[model samples]
Target: MPAGASTGLPLETDRLLLRPWRVSEAAIQRELWTERDPRVPARRRIDADGRPTVADFEEAISAAAVPSSTGLLAVELKADAAVVGYCGLVEGGPETEGEPELAYELLRRFWGLGYATEASWAVIDWARSSGHRRLWATVWAWNVESLRVLAKLGFAEVRSEQHPVHGTNRVTMKRL
Candidate 1:
């Protein structure tokens, strides 16, 4: 099977190309992780700073690129082929079952250009096409920008939950 067959989607947007992670992208991935906000850490199960070495980034990308797994897509710009960030559906359990959780991040320099909304919309469209009846996402209650993006994608605030580690309330949103 191909590397990202588990993801089962080859999605694209107007100015971005969304695809499975690649081993060759280790350097770029490392750079992005290094530059991530110190507070949130990009919402992965693993603690990024504790494992910020090159090898860790490699493993992360490899895991995300694997087929049939809840994975992250490498978002690259069409004009220059630079990896700006990532956006994709994360598999959720009983609390969010049957609804892939949407997530994304962009390099700080690339912010304010509407890339988040663009990439997110692409993922939503893909989910809709794949027969997913609903989609959901959780954001730090204080993250206004992300909430705006989710809202723009038609996700309404469904509820909020406390994160065990993050020590903050996460606002859950859903779209159907």
Candidate 2:
């Protein structure tokens, strides 16, 4: 484990190893957020170009993800240790304060695989062991894959609201 991370530990699934952040993965982190995907709305991209700006990169890193863990984790392949993308806990927006939020993203090439569900389940277990009573997530309504992933993990619709950019945003939660 890295220094200063008390509960920070590695989580393994059938094909992934969800582990601590590596400074080297910063560029890949930037790619995941900045890359164009039909599922992600443009406003969330922040950069006019397909690449991340300096501010966007800084905000993604060095940000508090989970209350007690690193913000976004680097999910790599167990077979070759190649970084696929990220899935981790966050403190969440105002409506979800005091409840941890489950979040994830994968490279478009890695889509349609079961990685999200596997990695998210691992994180969910970690949160439960860490004593959280509930877990929450907010998804862009158009992100059907993520909705399926959350639902498979037992998250039910908590509410739905309009977003200036993403149309209908849905908040879902699951009890730990």
What's the TM-score of each model vs. the native? 0.80, 0.83
The number of the candidate with the highest TM-score is 2
How does each model score on lDDT? 0.73, 0.79
lDDT of 1 by residue, 1-176 (tens): 34434455557777999887787887776677667655664554235355566687788766653434345788889999888888887887666765678879887789889999999888877776566778878787767788888888888877677777555545465555
Query: On residues 1-176, what C-alpha lDDT tens digit does candidate 2 reach at each position?
Result: 24575774677888998886665677777777655564466666745575466555656565634335525577999999999898888877776766779989998889898998999989998888777888999987888889999989999998998977658889998999
Model 2 whole-model lDDT (C-alpha atoms): 0.79
> Pairs clashing in candidate 2?
65-71
User: Stretches of candidate 1 above 4 Å error?
Assistant: 1-9, 41-50, 63-70, 163-167
